[model samples]
Target: MRAALLCSAAGSLLLSTLTAAPATEDRTGAAEMRGTAVAAARAKAAGVDFGPCPDAQDLPGRMQCGTVSVPLDYARPDGKRIELSVSRARATRKDPRRGAHTVPRQGALLYSPGGPGATGLYFPLIGLLPEWKRIAAAYDLVGYAPRGVGRSAPLSCTDPKRFFNGPSPAPTHPSEAYKRERVAQAKAYARGCAERAGDALRHYHSLNNARDLDVVRAALGEERLTFMGSSYGTYPAALYATLFPAHVRRMVFDSVVHPDPARIWYRNSLAQSPAFERRWADFRAWIARHDDVYGLGGTAWEVLRGYERASAKLAAEPAGGKVGPGQLQGAFLQAGYYDDQWPHRAHALSAYLKGDAKPLVEQMEQHPEAAVEAENSRAVYVAVECNDAPWPTDFRVWDRDNTRLARVAPFETWHNVWTNLPCAYWRVPRQRPLDVAAGPGELPPTLILAAERDAATPYEGALELHDRLAGSVLVTERDAGTHGLAGGPNACVNGHMEAYLLQGRLPGRHAECAPHAEPKPTAPGSRAVGRSR
Candidate 1:
């Protein structure tokens, strides 16, 4: 878990007036010269060959896979190198619309699925979806596993079973003994990562990942890169835009990450606490509205009480000897991520409360203990997040903040704390986070999408990013709670994205779109799903 309003034209004008003009070297002629130099460098570097995709054989369309080698440390390019896995689905249309930028005819639409650690090798599949089919027809949809993720030299610490099956972060009884145990677990996690990853961890920061993206761009023979970054993916994407504005043609950021340099991982978690609580409340209300089917309660508070009791029961006696209080919370946390999941989650909760533990246990089963690939993903996630910026080393600071947060937003506060605790003890040297503020006209216009009530990446972050990325347009999904908004069911948001990607057009000012009506309760035994966009 990680974590805007429209501004008037007058405000936009004021921002543009305050921004500094590009340097003399950043003018058109100089930019073209720089691009030529980059192309020459790319020509000298190792080239990629398109072949059948190794991981996903069933993916629709003509998918090609290749690898590009980038220096592990740009400062010592010849010292060490790592390969990043890349995949692309070529455009289906013969005559694709071109943007106004004077770059090698609008290249592929590159996408990054955020996780800081999430493997993006398969994200091109999104373009194959019916809603995005048209966009896919125009531009090749490209995806790559960022360094330290998936096939790109993944990072791993302890065995997945040992790591995931350890003590719960949220103790039923917050005794001193419980606190000590949690701290011990966090320390062990940090030590294990240090021992397992060693020097590799030092190279897993976001800046390095952004640099890697540039190499991918060059290897693809693209003079300009068009990208869509979601969730945690926004950090590197934003960094890419900041470092190489001349290279970017169009970019879209969804479920935006706040680009605050000081508050990277720790503070970001704290910000998500209230957002999770709010989403949890919404879930409770939804369940209450369907009391006839769930029979959990008739009021939100009543529903919450039932949930607390269930959690307590699971803590005392793990369901099917696997699903415990923490596991239960983890399962429900998905509800916070996407409202489309509410129906299944509600049904599962109803089944659990009605003395049938099978559904709950099934949900727990979804979180396997020995999935090495998943463990690798977590490792890379921690590696990038913990090393990207400084985290408070003092346990007392964590204890105090979490204790206070637990009082008002107990839903995911402590769980989130423990999830990020390893960062406090990360061995890698911290890097100063980038000051992402862009001057007016410094970069091409970008599009931003956010939901008003997203829990993972709260709505406030999108607004902050929109303000920082001068000339950017923020398209809001009013009352929506989903994390990634573009590829989902919201035609309003998707339509805007299509317009920007196909034609270099964005809203004249900040805009908002209403979400679909909340899911109505379905009749018992019906399999209708309430979709969320």
Candidate 2:
């Protein structure tokens, strides 16, 4: 997931200082010149109305939606304008007291969940994060879909069918044929999206996103902005501090990504495959301990063998007559992202072992949009990733590195490589990824949170980011799941975040939190959970 930050600054920097801006736009008659291939997309998308989502429960405050205009290119202050859609929940408790600081209007806390395509506008309904609400009470809690994502000028193909509808073909191992074929597919996907997105696709880089955040800050009427970022949002927030440090106030970055310019944003996922396997073993061991329940195996090794057998079975005769590698991988990927879903996975797997295929099939089809979401996610993902840094153009280099990594991380090696296949067709060539060097010149003192076992954003990445940010105080969860471990009911993790949000206190000297325990499962005959989010 990603976090969001805001920054307010003077008008754009000139050409010499504008070296970092992602694109250049012609200024004359720019408003009338919507002459890009995406004109049809923009036009068709325009009619799809998104009415303001009213908070029906009357929880505490009201939410308002508005648009902020930013330059298409930050280097040219007088350049064409791009609209950024934003929403805000005004402070619930407003103080009327002595002039100035006593009266609250400090600023807004903007948030994003870090997909190059993940929607940030739904923060209010995400019950998992209660800490976000607490912060909203004091400061306006605002969220916006970044460019090329969600309601703010979405990025999609003209005939965007379910991207992951078909079964995925599994590769035995990285071989010459596999490398060439997959590379071609990746390039094809990228080309399709580029042809689809047209000019809008070119502006989908992180630099533009960072500039968009600043525009949102200005529109919100904040003199300076506070930030709370996680995962990919950390990259944009960090960029804001560097490009315009003086505008930053207090900030928090959770599950930060490295901003080194040399790194390939998409290729980076390639390196993470083996790491995911390491965590998968931990998961298997946990499952094997309950062998009587799952019956996969009594040992982790046996469990892996069982999985291989199941996968092979499905490969030979597709499950439920339709299930494929895409569905299986999607189910497996869910467990990798968060530990809370482990039971759900266990239930599906156990049922499958018992020759009951419905549960497993249902789980795989839980979110058909998941695959499409994965695709669109990859589009925005590559737009930002490719622009962030240069990737090795040589197929041999990628093949060699992936081949080496697959030796150990075979489970996700091919899966990840295929996931990023679109990068080969990305419209923009490699640009320097931000070198995230946080210092006195950038960012205020920040609070950073990380779960020890988070596979997506590993703990080491958090520690490294913490080291870079001079004002950052790191809170380490001894054993936890997923990236955003805060705002949950965990007293240790939640309490630390609460204090940071309400009282601005950090845990002294890198405090540790107890691992989270999964909620006990309900028996078949137990009363039903009427509804769930």
Candidate 3:
């Protein structure tokens, strides 16, 4: 799995120079240039037959499910087709009017939720929220599991335990032997994926994912698409827009990724280090504010010292024989992702420091059977990211970069490197990433959201995308650090998102919204705000 995707605890703001525009005509001219592929795809999509979802009783709302058969290799549409599982909740209001801009009731509002491996089948549930009810009422809320993900011929490596439950990426010390072990493990992981997934691995790149989206668009009988994507999900969403510019109606890319061709996976992971460090400082300050309740420390530095001490102690003697230093770090990493998780994480740490291990132990424990599912996610994450672009081949290059980064951003630098180390040994051939830059008047107005201090996909990435995509509006959540800004706690961000989705309104120019207030100390026995990421 891409470490950047997994490091997201929960899951940014800015404005570009671009402005909103009227929807463009479907680029039938471009479609014609693609020759018979477009017609063939349309014919196949017309034949799709939707039925009751597999777990209709379990899923929310009136969620119907179906599958569309797309070619494993789009170049050969008639050959080796793969079924992509799709779910939909039809719009409630047949006609939704917003001001003078009444949205025509057509096409589905498709969404991709970050993780290259995250299943989108359940994402339509977001449409049920009161704030998003208007959107659901105007368009079908659509979600689909990308190829190699859940229910879509899910791929996996041979050894589940060996891949998931192995040594921590960040060892306390980087000895020569440890480096060798990591290298061997990475090679083994790469070999396992190639041996297990075979030719399927080659077809799992982001381009194929974009192509798959078009097939879904054709199947839905819609001329254009409206999309919302976050984290790694933004890459595919943007790529789809680039490939089929005229087919895009509206797009929301939150916590945007920098689509730098040279730094696709490797350098992107490195960029998160400093961003995570900034978030870590913010978390420490929050803990200090509640020192009276948790008794961890009275200053940010003090709180950090306490955490380091506790981590070292756990490294020596793990709590409840399970929550070691690595597990402790993993649990606390959530705090940097979302402010809502701070209280719970602080309470857990306080309890562990006072010799109670239940909270820490419970947080780290996983069901034994979940390893298979985890490996499946990992398999897809690796396939898409590794196949999308090249990673450094030399272990020494990675070691050098990580070692330098760990000096200042120790929180996630080394761990992130190991999380992505397998890419260096990937068996699939790398393809040059698509040029994601959109020419002037080529794409519909896009809303780009970014936090000032996002850790997973840094704030700078949002700026990069804003500059590249012409006619896009950038919305910044000033000083906020959470990932996946839209549908989050901030009404300011969500308001703009809803406006664009419902009425196709873009901010006049670049804009910024105030961050939500941080949580205060709660009385003992009262529940915390709970996890937000």
lDDT of 3 by residue, 1-533 (tens): 23343333211000111111221113232332263255446645575576788988887647888987777876555568788899888877643345445545656888876678888888778766666777777888888898998899888866777644521333644788888887997898789889988987787888778778877777877777898888888988888878888889899999998886655766677778878888999999888988899888989999888888888887777777656777777767766777777877788778878877777676665546788777888788888887887677777777766776667678887667666788888877776676788989999999999998888888878888898899999999998898888787788998999889888898966989999777776544556775334
Candidate 2 Cα lDDT to native: 0.62
Determine the backbone clash count of candidate 2. Answer: 8
Model 2 lDDT per residue over 1-533, tens place: 11100000100111122123333343222431233213222323342122355443544335656665555555544556566666666665433222233334446787755766776765544322444445555676777778767556667743446565555557648567767888887787777777887765666777667766666665555657777776788778877666556667777777666554433364346535645776687778877887776777899998888777767777787778777655776677757766656666766776776687776687675345555555566667767765655454555555655666666677776777676656544566444555666676466667878777776766656776777777778887776656566565467877887677667788774778887675443332232231121
Instruction: Output the better candidate (2/3) by lDDT.
Output: 3
Each model's RMSD to truth, in Å?
A: 7.2, 8.7, 7.1
True lDDT of residue 24, candidate 2: 39
TM-score per candidate? 0.88, 0.82, 0.89
- Sort every candidate by lDDT, greatest first: 1, 3, 2
Residue 121 lDDT in model 2? 69
The lDDT of each candidate is: 0.76, 0.62, 0.76
Name every residue pair that clashes in candidate 2: 2-113, 2-114, 3-229, 3-230, 186-421, 259-434, 261-433, 388-433
Name the runs in model 3 displaced over 4 angstroms. 1-40, 43-48, 94-106, 161-173, 522-524, 531-533
Put down candidate 1 lDDT per residue, 1-533, tens digits, no spaces: 22211112212322322212122222132433344345337633656797888855576648889988777666555557778899988776643344332223356888877887777778677665677776877788889999888889778878877656732434633777777887887888888889987877787888777777777787877778899899998888898888889889899998998787645666667778878888999999989988998888999999989988888888778888877788788878878998777777777777788888887786565355447777888888888888777677767777766676667778887788777888777766766677787779889999999999998988878888998888999999998798898868888998899899988899865989899567666544556465433
